[model samples]
Target chain A: MKRSNRLVVLTDFFLENPRKHIQLPYFVTICETTKSSISEDLDIINEVFQNQGMGYLQRSTGAGGGVKYIPAFSRENSMQFIEELRKKLEDPARILPGGYLYMSDLLGDPRTVREIGRVFASAFSKVKIDVIVTVATKGIPLAYAVASFLNVPVVIARRDPKVTEGSSVSINYVSGSSRKIQTMVLPKRSLEEGANVCIIDDFMKAGGTITGMINLLAEFDARVQAIGVLAEADDEEEERVINNYTSLVKITNVDIRHNKIEIQSGNYVENHTDS
Target chain B: MKRSNRLVVLTDFFLENPRKHIQLPYFVTICETTKSSISEDLDIINEVFQNQGMGYLQRSTGAGGGVKYIPAFSRENSMQFIEELRKKLEDPARILPGGYLYMSDLLGDPRTVREIGRVFASAFSKVKIDVIVTVATKGIPLAYAVASFLNVPVVIARRDPKVTEGSSVSINYVSGSSRKIQTMVLPKRSLEEGANVCIIDDFMKAGGTITGMINLLAEFDARVQAIGVLAEADDEEEERVINNYTSLVKITNVDIRHNKIEIQSGNYVENHTDS
Candidate 1:
């Protein structure tokens, strides 16, 4: 293959498998190329990934180690990817009765998940994220993937504490659906005081849990470096309780009768750029 | 290095970092040996993996392909790994006054988590597991890693319907705490009707949720081939609720007053086994 195409392939591999730790023997075997040849290819790809300021390819020495793509892409890429995703998400087929949208396929899609992880990773590229926090259930995967990329641990706040967790700090927040007091908890030492934390959730509705998480972070004197959600329901009448956060895509409107959903995004796109 | 030691080191490499697809360059880099030497090592290792009825390693042709380990270990191995895990859970120091075992460190331990995944992967090796189902949120990572090994997909069953998950199929059941109604959901079509599914969770309490899942699986006519939990609390009462199941560890008892927890595992030290 031509050198340019090879570089494209290499970069594409990194982009497709975001937050994945991979090694070189697999690469050489797959590529069926000499080590010198593969090394040359990686050298060029690494320079491009670094020069572009999007992400860099990192090589780990010794056994059980290989090349890992350290994604440094910015929020702009997030917006770009989401904009494209929004179009698909807006398809009438995705719209269901009761104003709900179908997103299981997207959530399960590895490629899409990778794209989502990269977006969050890019947004927090410069911030020293001590931990990624998310309320139980949906947000765990997103939190886990992004934390893995950032090489930080993930702390899951449970809707109901387990005896196994023992002596957890609890918070009561209203569920997005019932507006009833739902309790959540985290281990006492899960997050250090003054720790720089990033809060993420699969979806944002009224942002109530996000607020609770922020409060929890504050209780520990932890700073909220950034907040991100995979999708934000964009109904204005829902009544917002908090502000200043980044969402990969914003739902501008949803028409259950017509099976249509509209979305654009915030300036987090234009304001955020990767080289 | 001695041949036996070399095998151990190489096996560790394969276990530590697994991939669906790989390349030769990655292996050469990992082993830090000549291409031929590494190839020979892989030949032996591949045979070892295959002979043990574990996953097979397939080498792909072309410039970007390499060897891929198709996970095919048995559910029997999962039973064994979890048995050892139960030993850790039984440590009295892990108990709380409230009769709960402390598993935060076990949950946080990556090495343990990886091993859990490999053993879990052994189960359902034959089934085409399209989606791994688990009630959130601790089950999230176990589901993710197991899915990665199986090279399939995973879906988290939320305690309740979220704004993002459209039109969820909700099932009400008792949670671990035995408190109020705990609702979980599997989005419609997330698991195709009649699809063979494998369920995994971090812990089993009353087994209410597991039974609820079995009920939900009935709704879709999906088959639940096996159920695996990281730990099975061994209280005589709880033990009655669990049968025909496998666990990493069995928590015999928790003496919260003495901060003593007793554990026994059936995983690592199985009788009459040779690699």
Candidate 2:
């Protein structure tokens, strides 16, 4: 294979199988190269990244060890990237029933999830975001991705309170989709009073959950520094409650029955300049 | 400061604040250098990592864009690193009250958590692990870390079933630390029948949760290809129920009262030949 093709194959392997604990023989097998050749490829790839002023590749020298990436990339750049991503999301296929916008795939992809987190982290680099608040399930990974980058704790605001969560403060907010009341809660002490809070969610249609999160933060006497959403549906009817929040992507409409999707950039990533 | 020192400070910032979206100006501010100087440092550092086959450093050319590390380090190396980590745990200080091991710090650390995930992902590179399994809270991140690397979904086994999860498959097992009967459950269809499985946790004391996961996998007729842990306390008890696991660090013992901690190489890492 040509050198470029070989590099592509290596990158494909790296992205597909993200193990840093395999033995050298295994990598040699995967790359269909000798141990020494694999090492040389690694060296070249590592060199390419290092020369770029990005994060370095790490190697474990012991049993079942191999290589891993320590990204040295800028989070600020990620925010700008999100702006581009937001523009792409202008398609209309993401809207769901009940004013909900689907964003599971975005949260599931490591690259995209990391980008979203990086953008938020960059946006709040100078500010204090003591906690990341999101409703359960779809929002968990986004919360995790952001929390992971921020090195702070993430408090999941569940629609249904669990006894396991101990004592929690809850708020009844209108569900944007159904216009029905839904309750969201957080541990009473999850955030401190006057804490600077950043709220995140996977999608926003009516922003009910986001509003609930805003209320929960207020219950703790916390201030909302910013709110971020992966995608926001841009239908005029859905805007009944959205105010002063940022969305990375905007979906104009979706036809699940017809399998159509539309999305674009939301105002947040577009308006927010790189720091 | 010298270039090397400057790089260290910059790298440390990335490590310290994983949550912040990074930018050139931020680097310039921290290093007290010109944006151009910081850019040069970033290039040098990025080059070093790339040359070493460590990982890739990605750069975007725009006013708002800068550099960030997109780790593509090998999974094989991560698995080997975990083996080394396991060797470290054979020591005694890791043991804590009720035969538990303290590892909140490692679990909470972005670098360590990411590395730990890479370790398991490396181990299960060839295996088709449909779902990464773990108990609630602390294990959630580990499960996420491994899943992030493998590009697989993670399923958290709740100690008790809640309405949020809908229908779940419940199981009874002994606690790894307490060795008492406990119930854990997974949402129905969380693990497909006959799906390949890789179990992960923060610490393995009695291996009870691991055992429980094994049972839960069996309930779904899922195959548990291998098990991995962040740390394993060397229990005085005879015969561990599970085996073929990997860990990053080993706690031989811990004197929490005196605030003393001990760690060393784990067997998982030591067994590698470094090829």
Q: What's the CA error at residue B177 for candidate 1, in Å?
A: 6.6
Q: Model 1: how far is A272 from its true place, Å?
A: 2.8
Decoy 2 TM-score against native: 0.54
lDDT (tens digit, per residue) of candidate 1 on A85-119: 87888887777656777777777654466567667
For model 2, what is the alpha-carbon lDDT of residue A27? 62
Q: Which lDDT tens digits does candidate 1 get at residues B122-229?
A: 655555666678877677777776766666677677776766556668778765456467777787757788877878888876687788888877888888876778
After TM-score superposition, the amount by which residue B263's alpha carbon in candidate 2 deviates from its true location, in angstroms, is: 11
Model 2 root mean square deviation, Cα atoms: 13.6
**After superposition, which runs of candidate 1 have C-alpha atoms over 4 Å from their true positions?**
A1-54, A57-69, A73-84, A172-183, A238-241, A265-268, B1-56, B59-93, B108-115, B161-185, B238-242, B267-275
